[model samples]
Structure formats: structure tokens, C-alpha cells
Target: MSDGPRLPGVEREADEDRIVCHVDADCFYASCERLREPELREEPLVVGMGYEEGETIGAVATASYEAREFGVESAQAISTALERLPRRAAFEDGTLDDPDLEREDTGYYRPVDMDYYESVAADVREILHDCAGVVREVSIDEAYLDVTERTAWEVADGFARHIRDRIRREVGVTVSVGVAPTMSAAKIASDFDKPDGLTVVEPGNVREFLAPLEVDLLHGVGPVTARELREMGLETAGDVAAADPEPLVERFGERGRELYDRARGEDDRRIEPKGDPKSFSRESAFAEPVEEPDPKYDLIETLADAVADRARREGALYRTIGVKAVTPPYDVNTRERSLPGPIDDRDLVDRIARDLFAEFEREPVRKLGVRVANLEFATADQTSLAGWESAVESDPEPDSESEPETGSERESGAEPGLESDPDPDPDSEPDPASGDRLVGQTSLADFS
Candidate 1:
């Protein structure tokens, strides 16, 4: 008996046997901005990575389609993007020779706000979960849904349209969807028409659907691979599909065989639902490296508070707390401590993270992070209440002759054996821009 279904001869009936949908948010970051400021919808907008005052170097996270028409692209340096699509200030000041012609064309710029984007992503995920039995969240802006049981080719287009419309109406952001019999084909179809596109490739058409596309358009085929494929006289996916698999395998190894299979629309991957996160962490990078121990310790406290708050929101208790310190020139040093049991104590997370970070106190640090791992979602009774009570009771009482210290004083003063660190001003806020680039440069393999 065969272990499973055979491949080459299966295509005759495979088209009608499966229903997979890939949904990609159209210009996700820019769309998120438009949701906040509707006026930006008509204007060219560029969401860059630097928004903090005096920060001049960063990359363009995403540019609206209008901005892209002027040669702005995601991952391009912010400086380069400004040259193509000058800032509003530049237009207002008549800095360019064609200032009158480009004055109204000045692009709106906003810093990346990850927390806000994540909140928007959560809303989109909720809608996806409602659409299919199994929905795989690939990233903040992409997902794949297995709707084989919900709809067939006959109504797949309508189903996809409903998803697109609902996302626009409910979430205030547009998504492009592709419905196909295979995951690989579905992903490609999703990008067929973008910025609110819906493309469907039914079972029998999968081969023809992928045939005329460039080899580089296929998932997993990068620039170098595309060039090599061209050298082998394979310019389009059709050429690779028809080429000898053994020679391709010999040339590119297992990846060559994968290329051939994907070229023929043979992906069998399933939609895997998103599960609980493995860990929770918060990291902060300094605008400039600092040698002072006080600033580093203060940043760690802030990171610990953020992580602990997230854990509490998720009703999770962690047994391990860790700290990451990135020194000058990008050397990462990490230390973790595992507790006797799981606990959700925020103060404990702060103290443990600080203790773990103590070794690098005097080092010039560029970034700091705090993380909690080994998570348990059970009730608080799982922790050692008796031990916690004993530890708290063991603290020495304040001297009657001394004045009581205020909360701010206690926070600023370090415990015995720990170096004193200045508390950061509560009014000062860090830039919310994240390190993640936007959806435009993401690979098709990411969705698969």
C-alpha cells in the first residue's frame, strides 16, 4: 500500500479537493496610518523608523502607493526617501527648485508605533478566526485560512469577497485575499492584484496559473537562485516545472526539488492556528551608547515593568526571568534565573531581572531587555505562597529615628550591594518605533 497519495498523477482531481485562502493586508503599515488619520488617505504618506527628536538615521518602514510612484520604497534609507518625496517642511520652506509643483505633493511622515499596530493586528486576527476553522497568523499583517470545510470552489470567490469586505467594514483596513487549492498557489494568487485584491485559482488551473510567472515570483526563489535558474534555460516557473527534476536536484540539492514542486503548485502544507507565545520580552535600545550604570539600570526597570504587565494581562505565571544587555558594537550578553515555582509577581520579575543584569552594570550598554519564560497559565496557587510570605516578612523595619522615604526615593536608591541608579522621568517617553520592517519586503515563503 502507498504511504500517502502519489504526486505526479494526482493533479487530475486535486483542484476540487482542497480550499485554502491567503489573506495579506495591503500596505499594512500605511493602511494602519490611514485608519488613524483619514486625510492621509488622499496624500502620499511614508512611515519611517525614526521619529524621536534629533534621530536622523533610520529606514523607511512603509510608503503609501502614491509615495511609491515617486520612487519611495520600504527598507530604503529615510534620507533617500526624503530626496524622492520631500518632507512637508521642505515643501513649505521652498527648498526645492520645483517647490510650487511639488508643494502639495509633500509626504506625510509618521514614526512606527508597534503597540498600536499590534492592537490593530489583534483585531484582524479575531476576524480571521471567525472566517475559518484553522487560521494561521503568519505575521502582524498576513494569515492563511483553511476553509475546505466552509466553502468550495463554487462559492470560494464570494467567501473571499466577504472576508475582504468584513475586514474593511469592521477593522477599517483593507486586505487582499487569494483562494486556491494549494497553499503555495494561494499565496501567489493573493499578490496577483494588491491593495484590496481577490484572486482565485481553482484546482485544475493551478499549473496554468503559475506557468507564465517569472521564476523569481515563485516562493523561495531569490535573486541568485533566479539567475541560476535562468542559466539552466529556465526563465519562467513553467520551464522549471517541465525540466528534469533529477538534474535540478543535483544542481540545487533538496531546494531544487522543492522549487520544482512549488513551480507545479504541489504544496501540501496545512494552516496551523496560532498558539500561546513561548515567551514574553521587552527590549529598549539607547539612542546612543552610555557607560553610566544608572541609565542602564533604569531602562531595565522599565522593561521589566512592561513584560510583567503583559504577563498579567495574559494570566500567565513564569518560572524564569532573564535579562539581555547589548553592549557597544552589538555584543549580546544574557543571563536568566529559574525560580522554585511559577509566580506572577511583578516586583519579583523586576528584582530578578535586575539581579541577572547586575554583572554588566558598569559596561557601556546600547540596548537592554527583560524576558520571562517557562510560562504556566494555571492559577496563582501553583506558586509557593508560604515562601513568598516568609520572604516578605523577613524585611527589616525602618528605624524610628529616621524619616520615612518616599516612593520616588525608594525607587531611586539601590538595595545593598547594588549600585544606585537614577530614576527616569515619568513624563519622558521613549520612541515606539520597532525594528520590524513592513509588509512590502516580506517574502512569499513567510505566508506559506
Candidate 2:
């Protein structure tokens, strides 16, 4: 007889399939300002630290959507921002030469305040922790949650909305949430309809949803990578997904493989808490040292299966598979092999474990242990400059009035916040208005 199907809980879902939630606080720094100064709500507000009440010497830390409408943007020099969105104070105090500048034409400006922002972020973090079992806290303004165990595909939209609403009600800050089967898609989905938006990308529709997105929209595709992709005739994610991988690998190395996988919405990385154990193992003490290889091999298979199962249950991907042998007279020996990347293949685990144990197959064995190490857990972060909550007073809803932007419709889709790779020159500040996707810029939290 052959085994066909197993019952629920008998076999865990595939490692690639998961319900990942990406929560990103919209215009986080600017939103924190409105939380305390309610008067700033509905007004074009710019919070640029070091730019004093009447000075224009500092960089624009963040600009509200209202300010953005007037050509104001994050990282723009305050002097330039002032030229576009003249200060409301200047209009009120009649300091401008042109009396045509009405109060409505000007915007309020405030210095960046970090202490207050962090307290607000703390409240928001509390609610995210409660919604999912596994959360990777990426930064002060964004995080990734593995909600596979907490929810099903049928009602994932409601689950995501619930999170958005809870944060709005409790913390007084609006957040955009994206739900998808993979982390990369979830991150992109979260940004799909920003500013208190909620979008869910079902497993079946992941490919279709990602197909229309620009390569720049994909996570970790910085300006440099994007330029390279475009040069290779891969403008959108669909193009990259359909293109041959050999050239990509030749160009970007391992990252090329990663980029191709993400474009196809195939991220296998699981959301796991930081500081998790590096390895897991299963071992059994032999009643007596047996000289037979048949008995020793059987025990090795059992131990390998057990160790692999434990890692899977814990949502871990191990790159190294190892085995231990305790021979007669308690002499211990060990062997292991490391792979290029993390994986959750049980058969590979067994095969590798068995191969490693072959050296001791002929010797008498007292104890055998199977081990897996070099665990990889999902860790990820987000975009800033999204406006604060759209509807803070009443129940917030997705931006139903506005249509979500298709991949082609989005202008840049470059990540607005930190960069994926650390800057080689930490002290080298980026150009204030460089249009490229930048990293290591000053953040409100950094001020704190």
C-alpha cells in the first residue's frame, strides 16, 4: 500500500508558503508631531530638526502630504523647502515682499522632536507584538509579522484591517499594512496604497500582483541595482522573473539569484524573532556500543528526521547539517558540511547527515546525534514621508476613494528610508536631494 495524503498537523505547510504581514507607520515622524500638536493636523507641516523657528539651515526631516503637495519632500534642504512652501509665520507676520502669499498658501514648520516620537512608536509596537506570533522588528517605523498560524487566507484582509485600526485607536498613529505569502511581496503590498492603507496579496495571486511592479519596487533593489536591471532590459519585476538567471548571476552574483526569487514572489525567509538559537539537535544514548552498521544507520535516520522536524516547527532555515558519533570507550568524533544558503529540506538533511556519519559506519557506536546550524531568520525595514493617519478621529478605512497605483503608475517606488547595505563611510552624508534610493540618512529616532 502507498501513503497518499496526510491529515492536518501531520505535515507542516511548505516552507515557502506563509502569511506575512508588513506594518509600516506612514509619515511616522510627521505623524508623531500631529499626535501632540493637534493644531498641526490638516495643515502642511514640516518637521526638520536644527531648522529653528525662523531659520532655514537644516534638512527637511519629513514633510506631511499637504507639504508634499506643495513640492516639499523629505531630505530637501530647508532653504529649498521654504522657497516652495513658504512658512505660514512669514505670511502671518507679513514678512514676505509678495502680499499675494495667503496663509493657506504657506505651511507650518517645526523642529524634529525625537523623545516624543519614540514614545508614540512604543505604543504602536505594543499592538503589533500582540497581533502575530512571530515578528521581526525591522525599525522604529516598520516590522514584519508571520501570521500564518494566527489567520487563514479567507479573512486575511479583515485581520490586517484590525491591526491598522487598533494602532490608530490606541496609539493615535496611522499605519499601512500589506499581507502576502512572502516577505518581499508583503513589503511591496504595504506600500501599494500608503497612508493608513491595507492591502492583502493572496498566495494564488502573488505572481499577478507582483507582475506589474517596477523592479525598483522590489525590496533591496536600490538605485544601482535598478539601473543595472534596466540596462539588462528588465524594467519591471515580470521582466526580471521571465529573464534567464545566468546573466543575472554573472552580473550581481548571489544577490542576482535572490532578486530573481523575490521577483517571482518566492521568498522562503520566515519571520523569526532576533536572537533565536543558532542550531538544533536530536541525540539518543545507546544502551550498549553496537558494532553493527545496520543498527547504527537506522538510528542516524531517526535522529536526522527528528532534528529536521524540530527546525521546521520552529520556522528556522539551517545552512549546515552535521552528525556526531560516540564510539567504544566513549571516543567522540564529529563531521559537518555547510551549504551556500539556508534551506528546510528534510531529504537533504537526511542525506547529508547519513553521508557525514559514513566515516564512523564501520566503528562501534555508543551514541549518535544529528545537528543543524547556521540558522537564518527573516529580518527586514521601510519607507518614511508617508503622511500621518488619514482618519484618526473615526474608524479608519483603506483609501477606497483613491485607486491603488499599478506598478507602472508609480513614479519611483524607491525606498524612502534606510539602505540595505551599510555605508562604507558612515560620516559621509548623502546629498540632501539626491533622487536615488538612499540609506543611512538621519532619522527622527536617531535624534533620540
Candidate 3:
């Protein structure tokens, strides 16, 4: 029920500069699931594996902030989580699954349908491009937009609000937007609110706004780093800014200086559209050491689903599929197999992933990972454009019966009437914003 901040006019600037904004979909997987089935919106929804009441085989993928309020969090053991939140029965009874309802914890599992998640993520990406003048998608649920060319902050906030509404209306999800003078500031601002919230931080006010924030909130300050910073009496970002640099450097080396700059609201990273990556991986760690292979195979299938879904979502085809197993702290193993041609097939991915998992049959794996590597981000037509020309110019008349069908003929065809336009880059700039209203964007492509 939180309404975001209003747009403000620019006051002044030291020099001409571009404006950036970071937009992050809140509890993305949970939100996506909510969009898929609206009934779960008001419930304490959790998305993860090993929902078979008290099972330790699965980890949580995402939990709504509402769920988080009850101590549910990502990567936590599902068995322990049910003890904190009320257990809701699964859909087998045609009733909503709330973890707090049942005590015995029978059938507490919620399966991850990566195919459905990918479809929704793709739709979200489309919505992002529409709102951006320059969009740099950092992950499935987050993106940075440079809106300097077409609009400024005063007007762009309205645009962001409209996007938020449109996504809820058409896509059935909520997103948080953070606006600041720099990418670092903006990234932090977006997290200020939960689902469906927006916050704006102007350039001149960056230091004042960041001063009271926890040192852990700084971009690169992890829990370990935050603990160290606390030991140095640097509890808040402002403390880090005020601390002597010499002492910090003595303790943490070059990273210490980097932390100092970040704490002072100084990060200068740009949003660049890097296309599909060369590999995709999904991994899961058990709450306890897992020695059995059955649970390991189950996790591998889940990872396979994630890998295939990623390839299709990014319009990427992969030549190699691989698996990684971490037995504990020291032992790590990986294996891969190349394919005859680049493919986006889920069955084929599972086949290769499972084949690689066979190597670790005797190993006690605590964590299992599946990856699709050597990715190429071109449509079949784009990759084979030259081949098309060669067929047209063949000396003997090409087989008229062998003509390729139009894209629309495919079962999962592009939307109607929009087929003529090429798919815009997922990460494009936003509509222009005035200099003062511009916030920041995140450059990291991998999802945290």
C-alpha cells in the first residue's frame, strides 16, 4: 500500500551529465508466481524446493517480504522455516498453501516451474524496455535505465509510476524504483521499500540521504565486511566516510579504499547493454551435508530446468551443458559435454546435465550445480542468414517444399501486430529526465 515519491525539478549541476535509475522487481520469483496466480498475493507465499513437510532436500528461492517478516528468507532450510511461519496446506486440497496452518508438515513443498517464471520474466523485460531510454538488464529481476536522451527526472518519475501501474495491471507484479544522482545511490534507494515502492534521491542530497544508513547497506559491504567495519566503530555509512583512510587501508587493503568511496556515495558505473552470456548455471546447497544421490538428482533436474529456461528467455542457444558438485569446502568437481549444434531444448539440457551428474555418483555432494555453457545469443535465422542467401542462389532450383515458415507459425510465436519490429535490447535507456532528478543504476549482470 506504499505510494512512491513524487518527481522534483532539477536545481543545478556542476557539468552536463546523464541521469540513471535502477528498477528492481521486488521478491521477483514470488511476485512472478503471484502474477501467475493472483490468489497467492495476500497469502504468506514462499517459493523453493523440498516442500514435502520437514524435508531438508530443498532451499527457498524467494519469499515475499510478508513472509520475511515471519523470519523466512532465501537459502534457508524449508524444514526450519515451517517452524517459524504458519504452514499452509498445498493445492492438493484446493486450498491455498500457507506454511503456518499445518503442524505435522506433510506435503509442504512448492515446485519451481522455471518455464512459467521465464515467460513472466520475459514479459517483465519487455515492460522495462518500454519505460527505458537506455535499459541495461542486470538480472532476471533487476535493471538500470539511462533516461537522459528522451526525458528528465521531473517527468521521468511519472513515467516510472505509470510503468509500476502498468506492470501491476497487465503483468500482475510490483516493482521498486530508486532514483539518485549516481548508480550506487540509486541501487541502495530501490531497496528502501518493499513490493511496489519507489524512492528518489537527488544529487546534492546523496551524502545526507546515505549518512544514517547501516554500513552493511553500502553496495559491496557484505556481512563479514560489515562485522569488521563495526569492530572499527564504523556502524553507518557516514561513519565509514568520516573514518581515517590510512587505518582502513592498513586493515582491508585496496578494497578498504574502495569501500570508503562507496560509503561516501561515490560510485561511477555506467549502464551498458551486454547481450546474453556464454553460460547459465543454477545451484542449490543443502542445509546439512547430503550424501545420498536421489536428492542430488532431484536438484540437478531443477537446475536443468533453470538452465534451459534461461537459454530460451535470453534467446540464447548453447553448445555445451555442464554440472558442478561441491562436496564441502575443498572438494569441487565439474564435467561438461558439447552438443552437435546449439540448442534451447529442455530435454536435451536435462540429458546432458544428468549425464555429467553421473560422474559424482560416489561423491557426497553438499551442493549441486547445473550449467549451460558456450552460449550464443542469436536467433536461428540470424545465425544462419548466410545460409539462407546461399540456398536462394543455388544453381539447381532450391526445393520449394523446403521453405522455412515465418516466425508467426511457431507455437510460441511473437505477439501479434508487434512481429514487424525487432526485439529491442532488453537493457535500453529510460525516457529523458532532468539532471537533478536522475538516480543511479546497477551494472552487475548476475543476480545476487
Which numbered prediction scores highest in TM-score against the true structure?
2
Model 1 TM-score, 2 decimals: 0.60
Any runs in candidate 1 off by more than 4 Å, and if so which?
1-16, 50-56, 93-101, 277-448
lDDT by residue (tens digit), candidate 2, 87-140: 888788877778577778899887655444544554565466557776666556
* Candidate 1 lDDT, 1-448, residue by residue in tens: 1122222323323445778998878777777777666777868888876533466677776778898888887666677777788777656766656725656667878877554455455556656655776666555677778877666667778889998998887667888899998777887888789869999998889999999999877866656778889999999999999999998999888888888998998987766654665567776667778888888888888988988877786678887787777664544566777666677787887887787778788888776878788888875464543456455346522211211111000101111111111221222222346432322222112111
Lowest lDDT sum, 10 consecutive residues, model 1, at 407-416
- The root-mean-square deviation over C-alpha atoms between each candidate and the true structure, in angstroms, is 16.4, 22.2, 17.9
lDDT of 3 by residue, 1-448 (tens): 0021323553434354556777777776676566545566666777766666455565566667667777776655565566566455643464545644553333222555544454345556555554564567655566777665545656656766777777666555677888776777877787777558878777677888889999877765656777888999999999999989888999888888877887887877777666554466666667666877788888889879976775676678776777767554324456776655566778767766786678576677766777777778764642322333343234423211211111100001111111111222222222233111111212233321
What TM value does model 3 have?
0.58
* lDDT: worst 10-residue window of model 3: 407-416
Candidate 2 TM-score to native: 0.61
Candidate 2 vs candidate 3, TM-score winner = 2
